[model samples]
Target: MKKFMNFGVLALLGMALTFGMTSCSDDDPDYSNVTPPTVELAKANISGMVTTIGGKPIAGAEVTAKLGSTTLSATTNADGEYTLEGLAENGTYTMTATASGKQSVTGSVTVNKGETAAWNTRLSNEATTVSVSQTEETSVEVVTETLENNEEARVTTVTVIPAAAVEEGEEIIVTPVYSTDYATTKAATTKDFMLMGINISCSNPNAVLKAPIKLTFDLTDDVIAQIKPMKEVNGSWVEAEVTEEGEKVVFTVDAFTTYSLFINATLNQNASTEAISFAQAEYDNLYGASEMSVGTATYTYKMGSEIGQHSNLLGAYLAEILAQQMAGSTVKTVNGSYEINVTLPIGTALTLSGKQAVETTSIAAGSTTVSGKSYGKVSVTANTYNRQHNGGTN
Candidate 1:
């Protein structure tokens, strides 16, 4: 009976041990904590009316939203409705709407989790107009009379010229006249401002100071006041004072005043008439007397006041002339690339020596046919200048 009791006790202990082991195994690593990435989802339903002050319905506008760096673009339907999909995490976004030849419309919208946001955009006046008015202001005009060596010079009485009507922020090209006898081919010089100053754009790369003698272009009053007692040295004019006042500067200049200018020119005994002879002589040897019709070629071209047309035409003319002068060369291709990553400038050709694919090329540049004789092939490559595509291949 004692042996039977020992067996029972051992059996009970084994059962308890087995239950403990099963509980430990059940507590193994649980993957329920490893959740999948939360995909943010949203949509945009935007609607708005665009009309002029006269209440004309403007159609076919484009609406866009910029959230952080990501952007969503959509175009308006004929009814002026736009819908966008696949928006990311909720955030505030800058919304903009635009149409051709119309002012752009803008607004903002805040999106929430799984929420569809509504936005409305309206556009206003989009045209730019300029008006010109002139104030009664003193003007200065200088005329050169004669010069007597470096010792004495006879300058005509300075006069006042009427201020012309100019639009605000417009550039006025002022040409200062100098006596024909004034020194030419000088080392460097400076000219002082005596009248008519205009403001300059600081960040404007187009704002520039240049000269024939001492002409001022787009001079502002603030610039003149700051640079008063202006002096010229080492070929450039330097302002004598600081006129910048806080963020705004005032430009003003005295009228009928004379500014001193120092020039570093070698006094040549030859006059301008003699200079023409030199021009004729140079051209005479190059193309003979026939090409020496060296008087001003007064052809009407697009340029500034001198040409009275578009200035871009001047550069186009030079490029065309250069191409025409090339001999025995037909532009096979203007731009060529071998590797997929390679690129070349327009009007440039790359010759592939070996193991390169052969591609046919074509041209569409505006060219005049002179009796089937091409002075030079004007190959206009795509994505280049204003000239039409002169050459290409499919």
Candidate 2:
């Protein structure tokens, strides 16, 4: 008898996906204005067989694939097959294959340059009981029920979520300007600026089954401006304004990095929620930053059409570094604002480092709670080859 295990969406898996980026130095200057290598193309092939506890192929089962950094979908065919094409790089790829009830799976794959690889998966029996569990910046574990015949065909799946989710809110980008000469006079804003539509992923398969997620902001930018500052000019306090002349300023914001989705997993006969929670917490504390900063955010900024294309979040950080690298640069301070962005060396990495905590094992065993922390160092590196060719050399 073939045992059956139905792990819900495999969101809490702690898999490491490394992005190999080469950094450039100003000393090794090219000066040519070269265009950095943008995502030229991207593609995906999703093929999977749908089966029941009774061992029969179910036609027309839905299987969708998400391309690098985007939430768009490419679904499977009537023959239980699917594929996503037109991806650019031959880097690490994250995929989620799903069909109703049959445990959904999310995993990472390496797609070689111009290569059309095959992604074949098998769907298991539908889940009997809906349950949920979570681990902070670590990993999420989910187990499924055994086959009716008492065979052990259980599946425990884990997926890595961004560390930011566990901490507070989705990651935000802020821009502040500084004077080329006087770096101490912090710049000021007259109005409250808004950078909206920030989206975060829930890496816990069980999270979706539990409750909707919420992230609050609490970030400070010692380099740029977070909250604008003002002083009493003529007996009345008013916001300071930035004239054509530059002023030094710092900025920052904090928010939830997870989504409104929930996860629900059950404790099947073969699997324990305790084991899963522990594994996830450890993983988050170890590599959550790397996966999000390097894996998800970097990938999105480099490829996606949303915020990545408009705001040079990475580019802005690079610009700050560039300012820092110049001779005789200094930082400015604001009176009322807490967070700010300071000028830093161009092409220098903005290390994003932090940590997360494990929620509770009790939640997995029928309780209604999930928790954890998300921490790490998020640094941005400039494209060396592109800078050499484009930054004036060309």
Point out the worst 10-residue segment of candidate 1 by lDDT: 299-308
lDDT of 1: 0.31
Off by over 4 Å in 2: 1-68, 130-394
Error of 2 at 296 (Å): 32
Q: What is the lDDT of residue 149 in candidate 2?
A: 31
The alpha-carbon deviation from the true structure for residue 23 of candidate 2, after best TM-score superposition, in angstroms, is 60
- Model 2, range 1-394, lDDT digits (tens) per residue? 1232223223223121111122334345342332322221223322233333222334555544444664435655544444454445556566666677564555455554323333333344432221122334433333432222322222223222333333233222111112111122222331222111122233342222123222222222321332333322223333433211122221111221211111122211121111111111111112112222222111110100000111223222222222211211111110110011222222322222112111111112123222211111111222212323332110
| Count of backbone collisions in candidate 1 | 22
lDDT of each: 0.31, 0.27
The candidate maximizing lDDT is: 1
Candidate 1 lDDT, 55-141, residue by residue in tens: 234467777878888898877655444555556656887888788866565557676433334454334333222221245433333
The C-alpha RMSD of each candidate to the native structure, in angstroms, is 31.1, 32.3
Evaluated at residue 270, the lDDT of candidate 1 is 15
* Cα TM-score of candidate 1: 0.25
